[model samples]
Target: MARAFIGLGSNLAQPAAQIQAALHAMTQLADTQLIAQSSLYGSKPMGPQDQPDYVNAVVALQTSLTPHQLLDALQRIELEHGRVRKAERWGPRTLDLDILLFDDLQFSDERLTIPHYGMRQREFVIYPLLEIAPQLVLPDGTPLSDLQHTCDVNGLIRLSAQ
Candidate 1:
């Protein structure tokens, strides 16, 4: 099984409810085990900053799915939660699920990339990931703490978890 980490966030209507629903939906996937989850963190949107701040969390999973298959699953969950690609980059989203890491796999294609390219730079991603797995190492041997300290994002506030 590939040990994968997924980033989850929602900023539209019923933000917290939407995040909970997405986590519940993920637990129902076949051959996937929800191993650990970080507490929800509220943060300002990364870009196009005129919208709502997002509630973000990370889930660690043990899954039999390959990278692309996992991406497909995440996309399906987003669609089920009323996610639309019509908005501008970093616009308010009902549900935003991103695959942050897929074990040691390094993949690049027309559609997706593993070890999510932007994760290390976003405290919204690094902070919660540190809470769950602070010692996790990248393929290039970079410790998560090393990455977290270097990230410039601030204002991450942990919220109540269900």
Candidate 2:
């Protein structure tokens, strides 16, 4: 089984609850085990300021599924939680599930990218990711703790211990 890290976020319809529910749904994924999860974090929206702040967290999973299969399952969970795709980039949503890292794999395609395209720049993603895996290093061998320091966490807040 390959170990994977998933980033979860929500800014609509009770953000914290949406993230919690998504965590629950993750446990039910076929051939996947929810190994660990970070605490909830509140952060300013990355796109438009008109939307509510997002609640974000990171989850570690051990799965027999391939990267594409895991991505498909994550998309399914987002759809189940009422996510809708629109033209607006980084817009508010009911759920957002991203494949942050999959083992030590580095991949990119029209559909998805491992290590997530903008993860290093977002404190919302980095902070929670650090909480779960403090010593994590990217596939390229860059330490996550070092990346955590490079991010600007001005508006990030930890909401819960779990």
Candidate 3:
């Protein structure tokens, strides 16, 4: 099985409940096991400030599914929770599931990117990620803890334990 990390976020329709429900849905994916999850963290919206703040967390999974398969399952969960795609980037949503890392794999395609495209730059992503995998290193071998210090985490706050 491949060990992977997924970032979860929601800023609409009871954000905490949405993230909790998504965690449950993740455990039900075919051939996937939810190994661990970080506590929830609240952060300001990355895009337009007009929207609500986001609740974010990271989950670790062990799955027999390939990267694309996992991505498809995540998107399905988002849809089940009433997510809708919009032209505005990082807009508020009912659910947002991103593939942060998939077994040290460095890959990019039109559909997905492992070690997610902007993971390193976002404190909302980095802090929760650190909670679950403190020793994690990027595909290029940079330690996650080090990266955590470099991220701008001014508005990030721990909300509750998962």
RMSD (Cα, Å) of model 1: 1.2
Model 2: lowest-lDDT 10 consecutive positions: 146-155
Which portions of model 2 miss their true places by more than 4 Å?
Answer: none
Model 3 CA deviation exceeding 4 Å by range: none
> Candidate 3, TM-score vs. the true structure?
0.98
TM-score of each: 0.96, 0.98, 0.98
Worst 10 residues of 1 by lDDT: 153-162
Worst 10 residues of 3 by lDDT: 147-156
User: Across residues 26-140, which tens digit of lDDT does each residue of candidate 2 receive?
Assistant: 9999999999999999999987899998999999999999999999999999999999999999899999999999999999999988879999999988988899899998999
Cα lDDT of model 3 by residue, 1-162, tens digit:
999999999999999999999999998899999999999999999868999999999999999999999999999999999999998898999999999999989999899988799999999889998998999889999999999778989699999986
Taking the tens digit of each residue's C-alpha lDDT, what string does model 1 give over 119-157? 978989998999999889987789999987698768889
